[model samples]
Target: MLDFAIFAVTFVIILVGAVLYLYPCSRRASGIPGPNPADETDGNLQDIVNKGSLHEFLVGLHQEFGPVASFWFGGRPVVSLGSVETLRQHINPNRTTDSFETMLKSLLGYQSGMGGGAIETMMRKRMYESAIDTSLKKNFPLILKLVEEVVAKWESFPEGQHTPLCAHMLGLAMKTVTQLVLGLRFHDDAKVLGFRKNHDAIWSEIGKGFLDGSLEKSSSRKSQYETALSDMEAQLLSVVQEMRTQQESGTFIDSLLQSNLTERQIMEDSMVFTLAGCVITANLCIWAVHFLSTSELVQEKLYQELDQVLGSDPITLEKIPQLRYCQQVLSETVRTAKLTPLAARLQEVEGKVDQHVIPKETLVIYAMGVILQDANTWKAPYRFDPDRFEEEAAQKSFSLLGFSGKQACPELRFAYTVASILLAALVPRLRLRRLEGQVMEVKSALVATPKDDAWVRVVRRS
Candidate 1:
């Protein structure tokens, strides 16, 4: 009888401990409104997967919980700010660290040179910004030449034939970014294509793998991702070596080589910029042209503006800002397409948004998609209208969202220039038309892309 009682007591104790381990007290202690963890281990992760993406999940979350909401991402508590006002409270212009860089480093698993004193960080930032500025200034004519080649190819297409807009744009972007940022070695078609293949493999995995923990789960995927990453690193290494040997100067890589950054730092930053610059520039141009295809009036207005500004000359760096209407078209496309849906910042210290106090080290999500589409802020938020930005308030709202002025990331600023050049070149000579029965479904990842190939036919404008 004594042995039976002891065994029973031990069993009961173990059961109680297991229960507590699996399901601890709810971590929803911030007094902020959100759903509690669906599972103790993978909080809201399944929800994110089911909703198709983090951005889509945020849309539903903000709809239910208002502008500011909290959700558990695995074991971590993440607070999402979905309104322009909430974003304003969350953004600090003077902060030493860039949240985009932080998020990107975490995604790519690149850690070198991420930690430093404030002066070092600022110096690195300035170096990078200057490199991009210098690259653009020095290579503007080359960029224009690339744009003209693409336009000429499109012009060669027979009338009424549909073009694969996404594929063409991706190719153009890859060529433009690689040659300009890495070096002229990418001018070779085979080298450019090979780099792109590796890039696509690594990027595709990085987008989906980190979200669902699948990269760690699948042995095949893990092996392939590693192989692709190694190949990409090797490619970058070769470029760095060649540049060092040649004593190259005045280009993007040349600028980085001259800087005090370590070889690893140079590689990592180059990878970040190349991946970001290619994907963003491609998608922005694709979406801008796609949107224009669907709206004749908008396209005509843009053409009129381009005609009035440039007359018969190719676009130059000096004349870019003078095309105000063209800028508006690009701005509207970004807002309407929600190019980058989500961004995040780790709360370095405890922060406050409205009545809630965000705990230190919490992940704060800037739900940019939600903010861009908020009907309260944007009139006809779903419509593809460029004139909405004619108001000073709308432009101010955009600047606050980090899409304009100095708030724009270096990659985005570069993308804007590249895209503007493309639009300027193409719009004056060709009329973009959407193919019948084609619909663009958004696949929201690090960048928003069409789920299927977006096709359009172009008619020569007399």
Candidate 2:
């Protein structure tokens, strides 16, 4: 038995050696600098996984190496770009697909395909625009109604008591997005809570499954993920069935049903939007609140603007223009929090940047967090200053990579609108104060979140 075990291990090692000899794991460019080959453990993925934080690790790599550095993600050669110019060169002309979608495909065990021809892309774009219009114009009141519910809950909370802001924000986001995007209304709190539970499960699994093989490795987790997907699909299908029976028009899901796409395709698209819409928007609100709490001056100024613009009335689409200071605050929060820290693309053909060659099929990552804080572009990059965004003149000095940019995710516009509405509702009603001496730790997750509870004492404004 011992001899057989030795022979088996020797055979496996030899097989791996032969595979490496025949086809090298990574491509190397002569001028590119990266960690030595010896640093890569367990087929080039260990360095990334073993690092404490992927975002900080990549930032460190860019600081050590130059703008364009080479690394590997699980045997795939990856070149990471850490400058605005470098990223612009690559992403501007090639904004057809987003990194999240690519990551989604991989997580769902699908081949890396960005899904959409020219006509399809046009249709999808139109659909997105229409959805945004309906959401902002026709559905604005509904969203405000949801926000008011959140406000009422907060108002009822004991004074000077800390609340887990993310949970409340996530609950609000999930309901608002689902209602607006899917036209699915929750009649009771229990139903909304049920949907959110499944959403949390699938979302958590997707984040874990991207870098680790946990979904496939752990049978219980794999079953949970599958069950969540199945449950979500059933819920979506029920919505479709109800829409058909009721003959609803001008709904995003209804539009999908009208299209010549399979039920499976519709479900896939809706699920992606629902998951991303809920989580990213939740994180956005959480970070916005955190930043506002940390900067009392900004919060005061924002309140002044809100008071001046809307007066006692609720925020509307028409009034959004006059809320420039609030916009600046949110923009600064996005920049400082560095939400969606990484964007990725695949090199279709050979490319070159500054005497370095990028071979075909190489995975490229745009490190947005590091670039957003580039000292050369912004003054005191680490400081959170809403005034920094007051002028378009100042913005031109640095790239204002907002929710919609060349490399920005498309759903970001929808998420931004939702976040703006939530902020508009809350800033006027409550004052958020962070617990003293609590450190604000930005954690790297599917979306960046606070390392701790992100508790804030909510006080109703007199």
Best by TM-score: 1
> Model 2 — which ten-residue stretch has the worst lDDT?
1-10
RMSD (Å) per prediction? 10.2, 7.7
Q: 1-462, model 2: which lDDT tens digit per residue?
A: 011001111221122222233233345543467875534444444555455555676888899998988765434456778876676556333444455654554445433123557466556545544554554466777888988898889889999988877667777877877776666476467777788777767656544542345568889998988998789888987786777667755566776676665666666666767766776777778888888887778888988888888888888887876787877777777778877676566666677876678776566666777887888667788999989886674465344443433324656666667778878888888998988988877775335666656678888899
Candidate 1, residues 1-462: lDDT per residue as tens digits?
011001111121122222223223334456678999888887776787678667888899999999999987666677889999988787343366666665566556676766677788888888888888888898898899888989999999999888988888888888888888887777898988888778767766655564446779999999888998898988887777788878655568878888888778888878877877887888899999999999999989988998899999889999999999989999999999888776666666667898888776566778898999999899999999999999999999999888999988888889899999999999989999998888888766556777777899999997
| Error of model 2, residue 175, in angstroms | 1.4
Clashing pairs in 1: none
TM-score of each: 0.91, 0.86
